[model samples]
Target: MSSLPPASFQTPRQIFAAFDRGDLSRESFREAMNEHALQLIEEMEEVHQNPVAAWMEHLRSRRAAGKLGREYGEAMVRELLVALSEVPEFPLARWIWNADRPHLPLYCFLRPKAEPVFRIQKIVCAPFVVMVRVEYGSSEKSATVREKFTFTRDQVGRLRMSGRERVK
Candidate 1:
């Protein structure tokens, strides 16, 4: 089992680390976060039903080619959703996706008091269709040598890793 939320019940959080400290109401924040998540769920359901968009189509093609498996894509979606949950501002998530994905799965670890920085080096990006980059490693330890993984948006419209990541 993974520390993942069921589709209907997402784990609530402070959700606004990027916001300047302010006097926003907790209830308001929760309401806004929930609403944002609901909208994403609605979008995901739509894509899951009709995966015609480029990303979704790409995922389907990779799975059919056996370069990416269904579970792999699902895992990426789950992990991306979990990471996105930590971000409250909707636009911020999109920004992170565009600018920080090269360092993603890395972004999943973003948390307050988490000042430690790590470097990820990408080695390859062409092997798996789900791969956003070819290879990457942190400063502490490199990933499995030549063992590759990826993150992609599933038909459900959730961002998921391409392969299994060990979770305790």
Candidate 2:
């Protein structure tokens, strides 16, 4: 039996396919669609305070604990810049900063000096950027690899992961 909670929601494709098939439960579909947005916004309030500063502090902490890999902080900040692209250039970022909203959740993996129980993986499609940093191996040996997945959010006013490209 796998320890990872069975993925709780349907994939974007699955939901819409079921919708087309006329077998979709509206409530289940809503909940399923909400899952990604919800996960992404888990700590959004905190990030909104000052996205740059908050990220800096987070990176600092990760570095202090020897969890962050080379340039991962810079990588995260760069990816963040892309994620908040338009909003930050205008006043929207400030608005979001002051708004009552949850903080964005980063799909980050922090490792101690130990072997990983399982590998982590996720797909994010963009103008939105999904940043991932992974450390694998054991206390005696390990390796860290970073990747950025870019996606363009569909503009039909629907929430979905539409396009994906492995940027590195």
Per-residue alpha-carbon lDDT of candidate 1 for residues 1-168, written as tens digits (9 for 90 to 100): 001123343233334631235544677667767775785576467557655653554444344323222334434433443544333332223212332233443333221111121112222333233443221122123332122335555577544565533221
Query: What TM-score fits each model?
Result: 0.28, 0.28
The segments of candidate 1 whose C-alpha lies over 4 angstroms from its true place after superposition are: 1-15, 18-20, 52-56, 60-168
Candidate 2, 42-69: lDDT as tens digits: 5466468668855665564455324222
Clashes of 1: 12
- Candidate 1's displacement at residue 153, Å, is 30
Compared with the true structure, all predictions reach lDDT values of 0.37, 0.37
